[model samples]
Target: MGSITERLSKKDIEFIENQKMFFVSTAPKDGKINLSPKGLDDTFKIIDENKILWLNYFGSGNETAAHLLEDNRMTIMFCAFDGEPNILRLYCKAKAIQERDDVWEEYISHFSTKRAARQVFEVTIENVNNSCGMGVPLYDFIGQRDDLTNLYNKMSKEEHITYMKKKNLVSFDGKDTKLFED
Candidate 1:
């Protein structure tokens, strides 16, 4: 059975910080669900008991951002794959803050290093829950892949913008992400 809480406890925060990866799920009112695996150190931060921030990097699609625009509902899940069997889920309302947004600089500072940062997802926690993940299989911890960062870093500013316009501006279901729109 799972237990629900209003906010994250000290123990929960510690577990979150130690995890190497997490999953983000979102969906529009009538489109396909989007569940993405997120990794890379320093990409996620806990602002408070009821708030968290995730720095999103360039990806093949911008489903999360698009879905947030359509409906703010989002859920982030973290699993303990190498240690004790546990799972944590934060039910939240998320806002996608694009690089062009005025508050981008403020939120981006939370990350030590930035590369190909597409957006900053500000999540307002609505509910926190934990369940025994005894069924989750253990996996060895490996280092993060640097290919995505390296590819984006190699592009010039104009090229990067063009790339985003072509690739990251729309969801797979044809919803506008509004990433570059004024």
Candidate 2:
């Protein structure tokens, strides 16, 4: 069975902190929905019972940021693949703070990434829910991958900026991500 709550309790926060990865979902008013798997150390932070922040590294698509521009609706999900059988969902309204934004530095400081972050998603949680995830398959825990960090380390700042301008500026559905545009 599933249960809904108004806020994230301490136990909930602890569960989030222990999870290795989570999925972020977002969508425009009318278009393809975006669900991304995010995994990296210190990539996510629980700002409070009602707020959460996650660092958005450069990727092939910028759908989440673009979708946020069109609509604030977002959902984050975490499933326990070890020790416990629980799945948690956070229903939220989110805003993408791009690298060019004034407050970007503040949020970026929460993460330690060698790769240039395209944006930081700030989510205001509206509802919290948890359900038994007994059906979810368990997997062994492994160390994080360094491919992204290695690639970013090789690129100069200008090259990184150019790459973001080219690839992260637009969503798959033709929506602007506002990554470079003020």
What is the TM-score of candidate 2?
Answer: 0.96
Q: What is the lDDT of residue 36 in candidate 1?
A: 91
- List, residue by residue over 1-182, the lDDT tens digit for candidate 1: 99999899999999999999999999998889999998888899999999888999877899998999989999999999988899999999999998888999999999987767889999999999999999999999879998877887798778777888889988999999999887
Name the best candidate (by lDDT): 1
State the C-alpha lDDT per candidate.
Answer: 0.91, 0.89
Clashes of each: 0, 0
- TM-scores, all candidates, are 0.96, 0.96
